[model samples]
Target: MKMKTRGNFQLQRVIGYFHGTIILFSIIIGAGIFLAPKGVLKYSSLNVGVSLSIWAACAVVSMVAALSHAELGTTFPRSGAQYYFLKRSLGPLISFSYIWVNLFASPAGTAARSLLLAGYIIHPFYPGCSVPEMPKKCLALAIVWCLGILNARGVKEVTWFQTLSTVVKMAVLCFISLTGIVLLVRGRKENLARFEKAFDAEVPDASQIAEAFLQGLYAYSGWGVLVRIAGELKNPGENIPKCVITALTLVALIYLLVNISYLAVLTPKEIMSSDAVAVTWMDKVIPSMQWAISIGVSSSIFSSLNCTVFSSSRVLYVASQEGQLPLILSTLNVHSCPVVAVLQMTILASFIIIPSDLILLVNYVGFIDWLQLGLMMTGLLKLRFQEPDLPRPYKNLWQLILVLLAGRLLRDTFLHYATVSLYVDPLKKILSNICIRNACVSRQFI
Candidate 1:
């Protein structure tokens, strides 16, 4: 592991492979599955078969990308996943670009998830009307502060919450899957008929298919969590790959099965009309237990927001160690948590709530994620060619990963550009500052 960064503060390696798997699994399987199945199915043109196929294909692509990241994690065995990888292989400028962009983007993501949790909590109050933004923002900031405080408490407490949240998420999903299974066991094969002619419907066009793939991929976007916190894991060289592979595979299977259950139990109209598909599914199947699924969904989003705060702080801490940022972020509190780093992230997220356009902020900033991943892919290949004898414990499987990501980048670029078309006026104003901000962000201290 590279500790060349000047810091006496060290993170304890308390996360064993099993707990590591739990944490990664919880992060990757966020509120997306509960809410996204409908959008994925809708975007796939309501073809049950095509929708399932898209889910499966997205899982495969995610697995490949994650394994490639595992290879990088094992090779580098460092805390700041993309930051460290790019700095070592691609050069500091590219690495700094990653950290700099993330400085803005990561908070948007954190804020978005916390706001989503707020929306979930508040929706019941105002049934049909749009949930007011001011209250959501207030609740969202509160949740961010609470989760950040939890993170500052200790890593053990944080991971323990992750375990509890993951268990709740899995239990809710399993309940949904089990209901479908029970129907099949009772000779109720009617819902299973949805997949009879999978691709028979009007298939989505190239652009639409690309958009649907984006939705599916978004649900699987957090597969690289193990690599992000590699330094804190026990035996990172051996365990990083194991945890990434295992967690992604399990989440993929769970997602597939959960989607299958949805198709089986709900009518096409029911699936399409309801935004919260799980809640609707539970309403019809077991009306009495609706609150349980709701709580589970809340936990799902909460855990994800918790993880964003927990992990993104590490980037600040690592950069501090590397002397790219103030030394305050490098120090740990009595709980062995990166208190300043966590609070920095938490406060940033709090401020981002001022924008009523977080969804747009998240969409706009998501380009950086693709850019970083593409860098890691290319950089790792470059590293291999440059240092052929470099000790690589986990082998990569990403020739296809690059091609797939390149296609996603181009496709997302087009779709994202089209999305920005609606906000061309505002986007133009925001675009003006991007170049200057990107260059100057790397030099900012404190």
Candidate 2:
């Protein structure tokens, strides 16, 4: 028999294919597209060929993993993706660990990204806004709190907001893409680079290539959030797979084109040096359009923040229900939203914004997120074997290969974590290093 909660929280089946698609896109279109190109250009020049190839590589890997996830989501259309998959496949302990990591990582990462967007918005307005201060932190926290309140209102309301924001974001992106192409066509020599020079500029070695790929992958994370809401999907059997695959393809194409546009005007050195490469590109191509892109990027980040708060809080709510967290967090209001969970997540996210180096925060969040994603892939593969008889609406033939790729993704994530750990303050590093080392030792002892 199925279980029920005190709030009579029935599974939400209101979202349809379009909603699923937009939600998936919103999840993917965060601060990544704005910042990742600059990072990629730093390592591998603004060579359109090289940049597009890198994005293509990421798309292929992500698509393979998405295929496997589509099958798993179809098989078990539940709210807690890793939690449910791990419990059913491996055991309770593994699932619990996944949930624990998720509880700490998702909200913190989302909050960090939200603050990044807030920082970008404030940058144009504030003179030389480099340092983090109370005012900026407060503003970022206010964004988180406002989103939390909006989410608490209801999922339907939140979804509507997501849909509207997503539409506006897409429209602005399409305009930028179109205008950039036009500017390229009109002999905008200032933007175009000699193909030979662009390509011949310092070829990255294997390690550099690997680093670039990892950065690209981080930008491409979060397409899987759509899977997190599989249970609420109107038709999990068909929509889950379609939405994941379609949304990822669209995002990859947009990212590639946008980068091409940015490079059309800005040199690799120029892009790497500037924080707001998108704005720089816009200022060069269409100065009037700079504010539009800025607002669009800001809205993109805000929508992502809102969606993350909505989706991740549900994970916490489920954890609370399963006794992994305090029971109070599981409680829902009249709108069937996890009020306490939202508040708690918002508060923690607020604290993360205090330090406020957007790039650093994004990198840290990406590192941890990729780790979780690798684990999720492992859980998916395990579940496929253990629950062979479980009905899967969509099945991919290359499941094992995709699973291996997903496992291999850990290499980049680990490298990023190691790099960051090496650079962090020694005292803080000692404390975290102790915990990490002790955990490693304990595992070995066990």
Candidate 3:
């Protein structure tokens, strides 16, 4: 067994703080904002206050997990985050298995969301637009293929596009937020009263509230994409934590404010029942701006798809480089991107889109992600004890606090799994299939 070493393929460090922040933000903000409001309202009775609170709470929990990962990313500063941490802190088999699961689950989830976005984009023009009956899978496959080609060509080639798309999406969101405030101040008394009533509604059953909270949590997922690119970011130690925490904070604020905008324009019941809440709210408030919101959603989803494909390929490529996967996957093109790994991920993601199960995929990937995060947080604690002298750029004194939070998140994840198993058995079956398929694919590659 020849020992593997970092050879001629020096990892690219082209991404700066702005690119890093937007990349992380875009990955977290995709599709969820559109899908989550309805679920939040459904379970929470359109109680805007409770819904916003849930988003905040989820963001806090996710941020702690992000900070924990920041310490680990800085300590390792390697390509494969969880893979590297698990290998160094635990062992190779565990690390490889986690990467295997991620390759199948995470990219698939991202692609599934992209396809769902595509469905929404085409719906206005097509009228009969639906996920299952439409050519959404083909459209999603085309997106994956295009992004894979761009990634294969080079990261530099795609970075500008990522930056542009992110800017456009943010601009749209800002416009919406500002416009909402303006409309509210213009004395839309009836709308304001409706929103207030919605916010102050009686709490629903405990189970319903819990379910809504979980949905909100899912919307706030994907903060870990920051750690996924630790190897590629400039000044991983200082920038990793800063970028993750800042992005989460901004995301939390945007979610709260935007949901407030939705409440201001539409009643809780309307927000809950609508398929496209953002577009619907825009239609009501400023009907002519429907195209703007649609374009924004499309751009945001596209950027997210690009970033996720880029990050996930790196994860698999690193695993391959470490001998946890087939060496073919580690091969880099002239652009220094992992062509084989990108292709493999795109193929798996295409399958996810074909099935038209975005919600199922999100929950399924989220379940495993929460588990991985708990393990990552535990890894942080272990590193502090075992390698006390390691040069850590950022250290958190709240280790015990983070550990307790991780424990609670772990329990929450397990309970979530149990609840889904008991009530939504079909969802449980889909998740099982995802796990089994991932295992089989990774074994084949190895």
Candidate 4:
């Protein structure tokens, strides 16, 4: 029923365009959408219009990035999509650095989402009871291992689960969207009228706007998952572009609708204060329908966790194929799955869950991911000029615009962080030195 390999194992080429699309959709439509709206509104100078505008704009930018990636997928038709692109266009150093960060960021980010999933699952049961840190960490680790085992079983199994999970999440979102629309149709004037004063507050400057963009973009982070599994896709050159466009367009429309649904039911202030925005809105809509929020959130998180682990393991497996990682990581078990790579991913994610909380991982992984993404877009541009004769089934002039915009935004982000760190670094160092001095003084007294 299965074949195992010790070295240079070949990945099974069983994933078709539809399954490929499902995998990509699973990665992109995870729990982040459920959580990102609040962050967008909170960081976006409290303007409903500006916040929604940023969401829609990020979706457009994501589509551009997707098209560029689709071209790469068609041309290269390999796994480790970003790493391979970087290696070929930029060189080994850049490629290695991207994976190096991926080693930490991917798993840690998954762990953060896993933790959130556990929190949502447990929240209803223990409304007043506080969840201990160790239990949460253990639950997160369990979830990671379970998904890892499922992935190791077979690609078909994973894709089946992924497809089902994605459908459930989509249904939940559609329900919310439809319910909100019905409320507005039934003369819910106050809720629908909230958009009238979308720009009533002070405007956020460019830096703040960039930060808000990053926040919304983080929710849309999984667009690259398909590229990681390109080798498995049947007729990748034609199929990848088709899947990219279809999945991204649908996801963007769904995200826009979900946000409108939230805004239609909740005030801006209420949205900002909400830790669980979906749950908060559901409680207001129909107190009895409140449990749907928890179920929906848990389902979303589970699907996100599955896709993250699946995609991240593929990256490590591909890295091993290129000799950027140990040969052991490239080994596959009886099911044609890279079991070792999955184990490594699980271990790293497990470690991340123990000490750090959710927000730290979110911010840390989101930064590294965006940084690598900007670099990947840059590599796409380099490939266009340097290898003009390469056969790309699809190419677009808009890809160039994406590169230019990404470069400018990255430059601005770097400068903003560097400027802030300059003042903060000294304070951090002083505090560190003072704590060390106190420890040494206590030792001397003893």
TM-score for each of the candidates: 0.89, 0.89, 0.89, 0.89
Candidate 4 on 302-387: residue-level lDDT in tens? 88788788778888888788887777788788888888898899888887777544533455466677677667777878888898
Residue-level lDDT for 110 in candidate 3: 68
Clashes of 1: 0
Residue-level lDDT tens digits of model 3 in 1-446: 12224476667887878878888888778778878878777777666677777777877876776776677778778776768888887777668778867866777676777776776676556532333445666666777788778788777876788888888888877877787788788877875786556456777666666566567777777677767778888888888887887888988888877877887788778776565677778888777777788889888878877878888888888888788788888888777788889889877777667565555556566657766766666777787789889888887766567566546555655666666553676755777677777786766655
Clashes of each: 0, 2, 0, 0
Q: List runs of model 2 lying over 4 Å from the truth.
A: 1-7, 45-48, 127-134, 194-196, 412-416, 427-446
Instruction: Give lDDT tens digits, candidate 2, residues 217-258.
Output: 767877677667676788788898888878988988887777
What CA root-mean-square deviation does each model show from the true structure? 3.6, 3.9, 3.6, 6.2
Global CA lDDT computed for model 4: 0.78
lDDT of each: 0.76, 0.71, 0.74, 0.78
Clashing pairs in 4: none
RMSD to native, candidate 2: 3.9
* Clashes, model 3: 0
Candidate 2, residue 446: how far the Cα is off, in Å: 19
